[model samples]
Target: MISKNTIDQVFETARVEEVLGDFVQLKKSGSNYKGLSPFTDERSPSFMVSPVKQIWKDFSSGKGGNVVAFLMEHEHFTYPEAIKYLAKKYNIEIEETEQSSEQKQQEDERESMYLVSEFASKYFQNTLLKTEQGKAIGLSYFRERGFTDETIKKFQLGYCLDEWDAFTSEALRKGYKLEFLEKTGLSIVKGEKQFDRFKGRVMFPIHSMSGRVLGFGGRILTNDKKAAKYLNSPESEIYHKSKVLYGIFYAKQAIAKEDNCYLVEGYTDVIQMHQSGIENVVSSSGTALTSEQIRLISRLTKNITVLFDGDAAGMRASIRGIDLILEQGMNVKVCVFPDGEDPDSFARKNSQADLQEYLLENAKDFIEFKASLLFEDAKNDPVKRANLIQDMVSSISKIPNQIQQEVYIQECSRIMDISENVLFSTLSQILAREGKTSGVQPKKAPAMEVVRSPEAVKTKVDELFELERKIISLLMLYGTAEEEFEDMVLKENDKGELVMEPEIQKAKVFEKIFLDLQEDEVAFTNERFRELYSRIISLLNEEGEVNIEKFINGLDPELSSEVTTLLMEEEQYRLHEWERMNIMVKTKETTIARLVGETILALRRFLISQKIDDLSRKIKESSEEDTKESMEDIMDYLSLKKVLSNKLNRVM
Candidate 1:
């Protein structure tokens, strides 16, 4: 267990902006920063980060919290894992209490797999440096590729011996489980025999965005034509190639700093680009680009430049990814290297500046690039050219922003030598097709047909609204108070006058609400509202101040999001900003304690009045001997009404 003091230190030292900026691109807006919501698929910027409050709120999804909360929400990290990540990032020393074997055994299986993968990475890397076979084969292969020793070490390059079961034996001797080895795809098992999966190949460890080793990618060296060029770890608990981008661990900072990412297609391409001084480069690892991977890059930067080989097939295959990027509201540009050249070969042939200039001059927006590349064959054919125009409009319609989509349509029409109205009509058809395909519609609830006195229902709703308003006011004002109300007695002096001693007291509305709900046995109908009310009361008791900021900061992301949505919603009666600035807003001169007491009394009176009205209407409508029962109910209602009326009169 981490000490409470250490947790406090971690929270205090970690800055919200600095931590979140690593993942989400933020731009200054007023006293806060705004970016596209990472929690949802949205085009416009709705996620907000406040430096003054040290918190973030996703206006779209409603997730808000401190830095640790952001990590937990965005990265799916647990509390302890988030803390450790922050501790590592901030270079803080962590002191932990020793855990018993049983407690250690209770750790999550995924986390355990991650730990085992990390251990295997270190073992393979150590073998490369310490063992003769690893040094001769792995080190030699890397050196032959012109990889400096520093680069080799930086990427943790390693090798596995050709001898069967060498890595398996070493891991077992070190007490690592063979089951986990197979689970992480590090060891292949046939019947009862287990052997290292990457034996006789050079190692390339694949990492999660946070730099944890999730799996590995190995390249074979022998000239056997039957042997595959590269083999990556199969899907495991921690590694999903579709959702993971290679080199994100190394490229994140550079991506953030440059505000752009250069995406290529191989591990060596990534290594060579970084080696040649372009640090913000990542690879797709030869898989089809996925929206998840695009989102991963989108979180760090809004601009992406895809570098592909000049082969026609390769360019065609990669054009599909551009539509995905456009759908994300990312600004995408494409640069095709010369024939027979990839990013690795191109970077190696030129200096960083020359290569950067070459890319900058050659890169074109998706629309222009797509048209120029595809229009050559369709120039003389009207039907094929019309089909090409439709295809471009379909891609344009995927862009969420109306303005961006319109701009692309105009560009498409101009480039294709077609009428703008023709492209616009195509876009409308595409949208209609998408709407039908998605079946997007607002859900309607079946109406309840309860017969009741309209006045009674209205009165009940009004009373409930008043009670809620009072509770909201009190919570906003004195939720942090620590004491109960003080009592006072009044005595008649002479004639019909009464004199009372004034008592200034602190009120505990939170406690009162809890106890009152328990006493009246009234159940809240809305589960979220009930949970939020209960949590607010608990938080008030835990901290002297309810600190709206801190309370929201510590809540679970889903709940926090709901609470933020509630608090930030505009009420029907709101003071205008100008009125507030001019101090024209009404002020209750009476103490907040008294206001709370009066508010509760008013709610009780209101509810009693509603009951009286209901009974009166029933008496007017009913015609039975049960009229006697109705009469009794009316009497009871009047009696309570009289008592409430007296209380209300006395308070006024």
Candidate 2:
């Protein structure tokens, strides 16, 4: 567990703009920053970050909060993981508080293993850069492959010595536990003997999305027939190859910004392309792709452009990954290099612009690419051609969106020279056998329509919901503003008649709202509104140290979504660049005090009118004595309503 003091220090030191700028490309927009939504793909920028408030809101995805929340959302990090990441970035020493022995041990072991892996990564790099053997063999091997020194370091490329105990001895001497070193697979422990796992090999450290060293992939310099040409860290507690993608930590931002990922086969392919200024690329490390890896890319972008080597057999063998990607509802394209070249060699042989041009020119939708490539092999054979059609339909069936499936089926019909009816029949058989709904889903009323249907009825519950939402929005936007307010109170004067008296008081907006609601003894009808109101009042009372990120991050998902929606609701209209039209807009910031008072008054009038209606109903339903009593109560409530209405009218 992290202490509150550490969290406070991190919040105060970690700048939202600086931390987020590393991932999202932000440009100044008025008093804030705007960028394309990192959480979703969109041409226009709907993501806004407020430097003053140290908060971010993605209007497109409605995921917003302080910097830590961004890390948690973007990197899928746990709470402690996010804190430690920021602490490391800001160079803050993290001081952990005490926990139970079992709990602490569980966390300590995982962290210790991570530390051991990180240390081993650095040791290998130092050997590659600083030692004679690593430099002569490892660094030379990389540079010979056209990897620049900068690119090498950026990827944290390293080399392990040939000596059996070189890495093992160093890690043990540095006080890394033997258990952790063995568990991380950096050391092979057999009986009393231990040896470095990647002896005499250049290392490629694979990192998690948060940039922590999860594992390593090593390639041998000399082709030893007895040993594997390449070695990867065995599956461990922290590293699972299926869920990890090489260069993802480096390529995540570029992938999101470009809205496309270039998938390749090997580490060199990724590094060469990155060196050639194509940064939105990652590799499966020569392993067959997995659904987990595709979903990992799906988090940053919905479009994937796979770069295949020129080997025809290998390209066809890798088509299984396309189905996994399609199952996630992501768009995929294929880019096969020239017959003699892979991504690495091709990138090295061309300029950045040329490489970019080649990718842009050759990349094709998966359907077209598959059809053309398969059609060649199926030439002059009807059976093979039928198999090709089923292949296309099978891949299309993996797509969850029915509309996307229909479009792909139509395209397949044209490309395969088959009728649309046959394609639909094949699609139906595939879906029915798989227990999925038939592909033809009839269109209903759009969930979002331009206008409401005329037959739809309106009710007071809708008005109450809006009024409750308005009060919460006011608290969210301007809870800390301090200003004077006029409070109207009904009192009996010397003439024995009811009269309205106005009293002036100075208080914070939150204080005024809290006191007004308390005086009215109001109970919010909406569940979320009631909870959020209590939370805001609590924060406002905390000596104005209102941390919006902490406030939002502390909430559950549903509540967090509600808060982000409310926070960004007002900014939605302002984002249209309305000021460019030469129309001077009056902002609510200038009149928060009045707005707060009017909102309270309007709510009071609604509540009073509701009460009067209840009493009016009783007048008709009760006995004569009860009717007279209800009539008197209604008259009194009507006079109070008059007073409330007059005050609200003046504000209006």
Candidate 3:
């Protein structure tokens, strides 16, 4: 675990604008910066970052928090991972406290796998750069492929010796367990013999979006016809090929900046593009694209342009991915390289400006690409052309946005030189067939139960809830402020008439709230509020003044998020600087006594009304033998409710 002092230092040193500016292109909007939300697809910006508050809010997704929360949401980082990222960015050294033996044993299995993968990545890189054979064979292969030393080092290229157990023996000698080595697909063990999996191959480390090495892909340089040319690590605890896209860690910022991503097929294709100054590109690791990979890019940008190698078989295999992208509500385009060239070779052959210009001029929208590719084969045959038209409609129906689907349908009709009515009818029939075969059933409506005075009861409950929230806010914001509170004391005089005396007393806000609630036997109805109430009172008793920032840091994420939300509720209004406009707004400090008294009176009245409701229900359901007793209880509750209602100036 990270030390509290280190976390605080990170929070204090890191600026929200500086951190978010790395991933988002923020434009100055008054006191805050606004950008398109990284979490959703939108044209206008709804993501706002407040430097003064050290927080950000994405109105599009309803997610808002401090700098750490932005990383957790956008990068999918854990709390400690986010803190460490900020600390590194701000050049603050992190200090982690030592854990107990049992605490170390209880670490998560996923984290252990990540640790092993990280260690193996460093091991492989060291082998490539330091060892003699690695310098000769591995470094030579990458250099021959037109990769500079800078590129090789940036990608963390490496090599494994051709011997069976060379890498395995060294790993075990370094105290790494055999189980983790095998689990991470770094070693293969059989009986008493253990061998390296990527022997005699140049290695490419595949990284997660947050720059953790998840797995490796190896390329064999040998000319052995029986050996596979390329090998990838098997699925492991931390690496799922379908869910990861290579080069995403390097490409995320560029993708967000360009509002577009170039999708290729191999790791080398991604590396060469980045080396050529086009950083907004990722690869599917030579696998057929999946919905998961498409969704990954969708988080950064809404536009994807897939670059094909111009091979017939490869293009045929990649055509299915187009519909998958469309199904995710993303705009997709297709760009093919020259007849004999792939992304790697083409990028090397052209200057950066020429390559960028070629891409911009050649990229075709998906509707046109689909129609042109399919039209060539069906030009001579009427029957085949009919099937082609249906295929186009099927792809169109996969789009979730109705307006986009209609636009594509019109484009398809124009390209096929067919009537729009015919295409629309075909699409409607396909949709109906799909709906019928989708196994959807009409849901039965639930029966409604009638309740008495539900609105009145709900309004009363909501008032109490608001009062509870105010009480908690006071305790958290100003629990130690001392103030004068008037006490109501009732006594019987000599004439047997009741008289009331008001006594003034000075007490802390927390003490006053605690005694008032206790006198009325009032308890919070919400579980979280109740827990906070008890904790606040306990802390006040122990330390007199609660250090809210320190208290929040020690809480779990959920509770901490709730507390931050409460504190930041009026952040926008506070940032407006109303005082500069010569407008004076009353603050909580000036009217805390009135606020506390009103809140307590409202809460007590609500509780009394609830008691009356419960007694009324009991009277209605009472047995004949218990009817009289129930009625008496209802009468007492009614009188108490009337008295409390009078106190709050409410009509019966």
- Tens digit of lDDT per residue, candidate 3, span 85-110? 99988899988689887776555555
Better of 1 and 3 by TM-score: 3
Alpha carbon lDDT of each predicted model: 0.76, 0.88, 0.81
Worst 10 residues of 3 by lDDT: 436-445
What would the per-residue lDDT of candidate 2 be over residues 207-279, giving only the tens digit for each residue? 9987899999999889789989889999998999999999999998788768899999999999999999999
Provide backbone clash counts, one per model. 1, 0, 0
Q: Look at candidate 1 and tell me the lDDT of residue 223.
A: 87
**Lowest lDDT 10-residue stretch of candidate 1:** 568-577
TM-score of every model versus the real structure: 0.60, 0.77, 0.63
Model 1 CA lDDT for position 4:
67
TM-score of 3: 0.63
Q: Which prediction has the highest TM-score against the true structure?
A: 2
lDDT (Cα, 0-100) at 379 in candidate 2: 68
On a 0 to 100 scale, what is the lDDT of residue 528 in model 3?
A: 82
Evaluated at residue 605, the lDDT of candidate 2 is 84
TM-score of 1: 0.60
Stretches of candidate 3 above 4 Å error? 1-64, 73-80, 83-109, 436-652
